[model samples]
Target: MTNTTQTGFALDEADRETFRRQGFLTFKVLEEEEMTRAWRTERLALMDRSNAVYTEEWAVSGNTNISNYDRHLDNDFLADLITDRRITDRVASVLGPDVLCWRTEFFPKYPGDEGTDWHQADTFANASGKPQILWPQNSDFGGTLTVWTAFTEATVDNGCLQFIPGSYTSMNYDETKVMEYRPDGINRNRKEGGVRRGFFGYDYRELQIDPDFVPDESQAVPIVLRPGEAVMFWSTLMHASYPHSGKTEDMRLGFAGRYVPTSVHVYPDTDVVEEYGGKVSLDRYGAVVVSGENRYDHNRIATRTTTGHPFRAH
Candidate 1:
């Protein structure tokens, strides 16, 4: 990796080559002790969503995945976390200098919780039914870059991420296909390998282009991470996680920050986000420019957090 004065953590040619071939890269982003301490304290603060951007009665009504979306827009620590140079610098090296952090979400898996279903996202319409982001017609890429950070120990027995190398070049599921959302289905599906998995409340297999197709688990690699470590990957990469085996009482938490070039239009032609069996107004939604400048005005940009903390670009 190359660390220049201008590019804080930019990847070198060899590093970039590896990322392109594997579709994912793992690196240390923050001090382990500091990250654990911060998460312990911030976890309590995040419970209060009174100042969140999406604070509609329905949005805050339950503990749905939608409720965990975009906390960086409300919390000061999260706001800084999304714009941290350790992340954006490496992201910009692959996605170009001009980038926007359009969304962030917290993924938590408690003991006995089901693992996530194997999935790949391009337009991100698998759940919402409407495309959340749109790339230019001539662009070569369609999906955003995702930086997922572990806020706690991520072990195989406690729900660590799994990936299929080089699976990002082609998509296996059709995003336009509709999937039924059955809340009761959570933790109920036992797949071919007898692994319990589900996608929030929806069945990701319903969107498969080939009904009989199955992911080659033989080639899947588990990503074990220490607290404060992060992995960056293409959103189109085939990825999933193992179930928390109840071997330990500790819950595994991951924070994901999604990034894209300024040319992309986020939440195109929509002012509301409806997914995960809940709907929320996007009146206060704005993408943060983490590095370089956003030359396009197609997306709303947030210069500061909801708590009035300014977002500094790398």
Candidate 2:
């Protein structure tokens, strides 16, 4: 296993304890120049979607809630981002040494865009109606670790993330309950605080176990991030975002790298991903092992990039 202190991203006993209780942790991932380089790299990557794993005009906006999934397989910058010890080391601390980054996504919010609705995911079956990750039967945890990095600045006024601390234990929404997708549902609902938010055209409220249940905004905390900063949280945590008030012309962009232990099964019994009103084949899909050994053969492992570059977890 890659030593944590050597990479300066390892979690101490205190750090691990904090994460265990809070269900999330925040830190800076890239230096200033590194942040600049990542921004430029992602910008150039978006210009050409030919090499992207998922191909479909499947997004509500030009940024957030889109179909561009898993660029780490084809893009070197993203491949490096997934395996960066600044991320992997800490993730390994929580998920153990044997870890795999199974998914990555880009969330962009333009001025006047609606905030992402409050939600939590266990198997990530909320949108696809299929379990994307299944934990081992012996394990107690069932969620993936999501590391969300800010490519551009994210503020509450510009749609920053919000989380309800210690709310990762019990689930309010059932992924088994299917919600109808409506493209025109954007910016339709005005919650208690006049927050314009929706879950990619579907009302996350529909999956709530209680039809009349509502999230407590009083307990919500804003996670404002500067360029290159990141926050890691359980996928099962109660989380949401703020609406982009459109006070600024600059758009907010967030890149999320999702990690799990090697024993977890990714995209179980699936060949193609259908979501956001678009479909994409899984022929080129492979999980990138970020640390230790991948003893489980159920998942298709991507040890190297499409360009034949071996992935190093340092």
Candidate 3:
């Protein structure tokens, strides 16, 4: 990775290539005290008791889960981070000047909270029935690059994310099946004897991490980052969050935002968009364009307000 001190921080070249080839890059210990404090303050101010944004299918009232959590971008601090120039500029370097923030969501893996199972995000790919962009093949035309920022120090014990390096290059696993998942607000059941599949808690044990071949053990890396440090991985990368086994009470509070070249198709099928009113725009989950691209044609900003506040300064 290319490492150079810029504006008092550094971005290594090797890390940049890791992001391009492997579909992920982790910048460890990059946040300053000021940035961290600002995020903490804004997050604390944004916390509230509610669970609405999540579909009724995935709504559960509990301190552990924040449903349909979005809209905090209005908070200056949080918005700054989501659209941070250092982050977005790097993304621009890859996807070109024309790009948009397609998605944003928080994955809080708390103590005693069983972690999400190993899965790929490809299910969201074929949703539009159109051909979803594939990596390696489309490396020239980059797709969604998700940045996972840690609100609190993320250690392996507290359920930091795990990833299979370079796995995005293959389509070894079928992502179309809607598997049964009963974690937090997301719960679904299949018909008797009906085959349930999808990236959920159900198939954690059955699927081979790599059925075709043995992977380089050295390449399967687990990332443990400090608060303010972020891990940027592709949407198609094979990744999963492990259970919280750390001694701390704080959850692995992370906010993920997907940035893709404006050229890629958003939602592929009518099945999802018809049920969910959101058009396949860059503002999925109200992800505003902090920078780059102006693909959002419809003026529906007012309707993108998010319910509840689960990310305020403590």
Worst 10 residues of 1 by lDDT: 305-314
Q: Alpha carbon lDDT of residue 282, candidate 2?
A: 80
* lDDT score, candidate 2: 0.83
lDDT (Cα, tens digit) per residue for candidate 2, span 1-314: 32455656788878877888889988888975789776776687666767666565444334235465777777777788888888988998888899989999888898988989899999999988999999989988788899999988889999999999999999999999998888787876657467888887788888999988888889999999988889999999999999889999998989999999999999999887777666677876788888999887899887773454333221
Cα RMSDs, all models:
2.3, 3.4, 7.4
Please provide, for model 3 over 1-314, each residue's C-alpha lDDT reduced to its tens digit, 9 standing for 90 to 100.
Answer: 44335622234566666676778776643455755776667666666324223333323223223243443434445555666766776666666676556556677675755555455555354222233433334544334677888877787788778788887866544544333333433323321112222223354333344555433434556888888788887766767665676478877788777777655544443322311112222232333554455554432222223433222211
Q: Tell me each candidate's TM-score.
A: 0.95, 0.92, 0.68
In angstroms, the error of model 3 at 99 is 1.3
> Which residue ranges in model 2 land beyond 4 Å of their true spot?
1-8, 56-66, 306-314
- Please, what is the whole-model Cα lDDT of each candidate in the order they appear? 0.90, 0.83, 0.53
Best by lDDT: 1
If ranked by lDDT, best first, what sequence of candidates would result?
1, 2, 3
1-314: candidate 1 lDDT, tens digit per residue: 56567756899788899999999999988899999899889999988877787777454645378888888887888988988989999999999999999999999999999999999999999899999989999998799899999999999999999999999999999999999988878887567467999998888999999999999999999999999999999999999999999999999999999999999999999988888888888887789999999999899988873435343212
TM-score winner between candidates 1 and 3 = 1
lDDT of 3: 0.53
Best-performing candidate as measured by TM-score: 1
